[model samples]
Target: MIIEKLLFHTFIILAPVLIQTSLLEHHKWSKSPIFTGVLNGLATLTCLAFTYEFAGLYWDFRYVPLIIAMVYGGRKAGLIVLAFMLIGRTIMGGDILFHGLASAVIASLIPYYFSKGFWKMSPVKRVVAAQFIGLWPIAIIFLMLFVFHLPSQFLSELHSITFILQFGLVQVLGIGIAARLNEWMVEKKVMREEIIKSEKLNTLGELAASIAHEVRNPLTVVKGFLQLMKRQSKGEEDEYLAIILSELGRAEEIINDYLNFAKPQFEKVERVHIKEILSEVSILLNAYAVKECFFGEPPGG
Candidate 1:
C-alpha cells in the first residue's frame, strides 16, 4: 500500500511536465506567470484531494507543488497555488487545517524572497534550495503542533523518529526532482531559440555581404574620379569636388558597417577624427547656404 501511494504521489507530481511540454509544443503560454500559477495550483489541489493520514495528522506533499510555484514562478504563482491548497484542504475538513495554512504562509515567504534570483542560480543550487524550502514548511508545522501541546496521540506520532525521517525524505526528494525537471525544460527552450536565431542571422549576413560588395565597386570608381577632379579643378569647382568626395567617404563608411557582418569577421571599432567630421558638416551647410541665397559665391567657394 505504501509503495502504491508513493507511486501515485510521484505521478501526481510529474504530471505538470507532460502538460507543460504539450502546451509549449502547441505554442501556448506555458511559462506565463499566471499560467504557471494555475498549473501548480491544480497540482497542489490534486495533492490535497488525495491526502493521507498518519502520525495523527493529515499528510500530503502539498508543499512540494507550492514551493515549486514560489521558487520558479515567483509570488503570483505562489499565491495562486496557495489559494488552491487552502480551498481544497478546507473542503477536505482536517482537524488542524489552520496549522496547515499558517505553516504554508510562514514557509512560502522564504522561497518568495529567494525567487527573484532563483533563475540565476546554478541548476544544483536551485534544486537544493527548493528542497530545503519545501521541507522547512513541514518543520514549522511540526513545531507549531508541539507548541500547542497536541493531543496525546498526535504528540506520540511526532516523537516517532522513523516517521519523521521518512516524511522529511519524501518532501526533499519530491521537490528536488520537480525543480530539476523545471530547469531542464527552461534550458531546452533556450537552446532551441538560439538555434533558430543563428540560422536567420547567417542567412541575413550572406545576403547583405553580396549586396555590399557589388555596391562598393561603383562607389570606389566614382570616388577615384572625384579625387582626380578635385586636384585638377579651380576654386569653386574644386570646393564642389571636395564636397562630393566627402559624401562618397561617408557612403563607404555605411557600406562597411553592413559588410562587417559577412561571417569571416565582425564589426570593428575605430577612432574617428571629430574635426574631419565637423569639416564635412560645414562644407555641406555652406553649399546649402549658397544654394538658398544666404550667400552668393560664399567665401572659399
Candidate 2:
C-alpha cells in the first residue's frame, strides 16, 4: 500500500509539469501561446515542490493539481496535462487499470463543461454540473466493491466512502476554479469583438459617404431613362410600365441604403451563399452586357 500510494502521488504531481512541457514544446495551446509556456514551467516547478512533502498522499490527491491546471489554464490545456499525468502514472507502475482509468475518464469529463458550445453558460454552473455528473463513477466503484465482497488485502474499505466524498469535493473545487478561468477568457473575447466592430463601423461611415456621392449620377440617369421609356411606350404595354416602376423602386431603395450605410445600425447576421448573391447581381445587370469582348480577349477564354 505504501509503495502504491507513493507511486500514485508522485505520478500525479509530475503529470501537470510533463503535460505543460508537451503543450509548450509542441505549441498546442494557441489562444495564449506564451501563457501556456510560462504557466507550464511554473506549474511543473510548483508541483515538484509539493511532491517532496506530500508524495505519500499524491495518488488520492492527484486530482487537485489536475483541476488546477484545467481551471487556471483551460479545458484543452487541462486535457493535455491530464493525458501526460495518466501516461506518467502508468509508466511509474501505479494505478494502471482501474484507478488510472477512473482518473483519466473523470479528467476527460471535466472539459465538456467549458466546451465552445457551452461558452455562453456561466463557468460556475458548468463546474457544478460536471462535478455532479463525474461523481457517478465513485458510486459505481462503491457498489462494485460491496457486491463482490473483494478480499481485504486488495480492496479493503479503508474509509472508502469518505475518501470518495473527499475526492468529489476536491474535484468540485478544482472545476470551479477552472470555470472562472473560462469566464475570464470569454469576457476578453467579447471585448475584442466590440473593438473590431467599432473600427469597422467607422470605416463603413467613410465608405458610405463616398458611395452616396458616386451613386447619385447613376441613379439620376436611371430615372431619366425610365421616364423616356415610359413616354415612348404605348399606354397598353402594362409590362413596360411594370419594368419602369420596378427600376424606379430600386433607385429609391438605393437612396435609403445610402442613408442606412451612413449611420449604420447592427444588421441581422445570417448565413448567405456568396454564389447566389453573385447570380442575383448578374441578373440585375444583364441589360448592360455588350456583344463585343473587352481587351481583345479570345471568345470563351
TM-score of each: 0.72, 0.47
The digit string of per-residue lDDT tens for model 1 on 1-301 reads: 5445655776787777667866564565788768888888898888777877765566677777778888887889888988888888778766777876777677778877888888787888888888877767778868875766564756465446556666677677777888888888878888989999999988887888898889999999999988888788887897788788889999999898767745485469789999999999999898777777864666778
- Which parts of model 2 have CA positions greater than 4 angstroms off? 1-29, 32-61, 64-79, 90-124, 131-171, 221-253, 260-301
What tens digits encode model 2's per-residue C-alpha lDDT throughout 1-301? 4344444444544444444444433343534534542444344334434442221223244444444445445665556656555554555553324554564566556443544444354657655654554454445444544444544633455665445555556545544444444455556667878999999988878887778767876777887776777778876775877777787778768777777657646578788999999999999776556433344568777
Best by lDDT: 1
RMSD of each: 16.6, 16.6
lDDT of each: 0.78, 0.53
Worst 10 residues of 1 by lDDT: 153-162
True lDDT of residue 229, candidate 1: 81
